[model samples]
Target: MTYKGDVTVGGPADVHELTDLMISKVAVGPMDNNAYLLRCRATGEQLLIDAANDAATLLTLIGDDGIGAVLTTHRHGDHWQALAEVVAATGARTYAGREDAEGIPVATDAALDDGDTVRVGQVELTARHLVGHTPGSIALVYDDPHGHPHVFTGDCLFPGGVGNTFDDATAFARLIDDVETKIFGALPDETWVYPGHGKDTTLGAERPHLAEWRARGW
Candidate 1:
């Protein structure tokens, strides 16, 4: 099936196949958190992003091919509810933004900073640290070898607007600034956005409403 990028808890995952990598996106937990399982076609090396919930489901998705790393996009509890369970089961190394790493209960094997490279077999993902949604909210950027850029934006950039800053103007400002500079400014319009929750969107779909999102003060 074609990759629609829409998924529901308990529903089947959507798989997007690229030239050298495959992304399997599943929605899990009550919060409907999205977990992405990426596999490199060349070597079968796998990286699981956000073991949000349902270790059984995630582990089933893993099957016999064990995972190498589990990258939590942020420090949010909902996003890592199954982190310990999954890590314990697979012994996969844990990764998180450096500042948010201390907040997670599990020990981070890697404390990533902005522009860090995360590898899954032959594929490489660039970590773009966008602040304010949390002290450390990193979005992984995969410059697809065959197509446009694909970004795994945690809770930072969503379909309609940016992530919640809890009404703190300072935090909101920081988040918006980082998003604008690192995401909207740096990436192209066709960039595919895989957010932490809800459905997917593209940069072009949300670019014209930047000022509106700012004025609404979300």
Candidate 2:
């Protein structure tokens, strides 16, 4: 339950006012897991990612925020435990992978697959499956208003570490490979990565660490 750093507040305006999207990060509960509020400036369309264990905090921050949907990265309790409450508060549809759909208490409004695109106002998010930490882990990829792509990695990839794996080691390795080749390699160097835990990092900063992590057999 350590608070690693201050909760970062950022958006399209924080970078450039001309950008049409805004993103805000709220660190909730003792775990300090980051929950992102992605808002489309043009239409006031919003998406909440990973409510974590603290429903009240998330609800308070998202009060009448006009959330359009809730996107979950995996089935971990610390990541999605507040999903039901958030959905009830916002009356927003929930999206998750079909494989982990049953684990979630509420009915999933949409079952996303790898490469599927989800549109929120002017934002288009491409779902990339990365099943190492859980059977249905995925990352959301989209082009920011600045035209630079960004990835919401959840627990799949952190600034200096990868997601915890209760599954087989070999399977986790494969997941790491998918993240490197498909996610990190696919995006531009300037692409921002918002992870479930820790500070935000760029693809350029994390790319060199991939080789070191792979060498360590993570």
Local distance difference test values of all predictions, in order: 0.95, 0.78
Worst 10 residues of 2 by lDDT: 9-18
lDDT of 1 by residue, 1-218 (tens): 78989999999999989998999999998899999999999999999999999999999998798999999999999999999999999999999999999999999999999999999999999999999999999999999978999999999999999999998999999999999999999999999999999999999999999999899887
Q: Who wins the lDDT comparison?
A: 1
Q: What is the lDDT of residue 175 in candidate 1?
A: 94
Which residue pairs overlap in candidate 1's backbone?
A: none
TM-score for each model: 0.99, 0.88
Question: Which candidate's TM-score is highest?
Answer: 1
lDDT for predicted candidate 2 compared with the true structure: 0.78
Q: Which ten residues in a row have the lowest lDDT in candidate 1?
A: 209-218
